[model samples]
Target: HRFGITFHRNKRSKAAINTELETIPGIGEKTVIELLRHFRSVSKVKKASETALSEVIGPAKAKIIIKHYQQTTNEN
Candidate 1:
């Protein structure tokens, strides 16, 4: 029973991990779409340098946006 509970929790955690970019602090569905259009994948976004991200996301939001994704990826 305890093992089953832990497995369920782990599955939920993994799902949450996969959606971190979709849930980024200032990013909404539209922005996520735009990001996908520009980068093709969350992995591409994550792999971008701050300067590259700024080019796509803009300077005002780039630092916060990149930092949010970086922190989430680092945490996981």
Candidate 2:
């Protein structure tokens, strides 16, 4: 007889999860704080549409946030 082992992964929301969102390329504490201030949560930040993010973060930083979210989602 043969046996196999299996593993389980946790599927938690980004906002509830305490990931180091500040570590994303081009993001820092200030930007992170600003994002949190405007969005109030990581899930909201991650889910924000480009235009909405741009309105809150400005064009350059908004692009970075968008890229970070895309990259993080891909990693998950």
Best by lDDT: 1
Reference-based TM-score of each model: 0.61, 0.65
Which regions of candidate 2 fall more than 4 Å away from where they truly are? 1-19
Local lDDT at 68 for model 2: 76
Report the lDDT tens digits of candidate 2 across residue range 1-76. 1222222222223334444667787877667777788988888888889899888778888888788778877999
Residue clash pairs of candidate 2: none
Residues 1-76, model 1: lDDT tens digits:
9999999999757544434467667776666666667988888878878898778778766787878866777999
Candidate 2, which ten residues in sequence have the lowest lDDT sum? Answer: 1-10
Candidate 2 to native Cα RMSD, angstroms: 11.9
TM-score, predicted candidate 1 vs. hidden true structure: 0.61
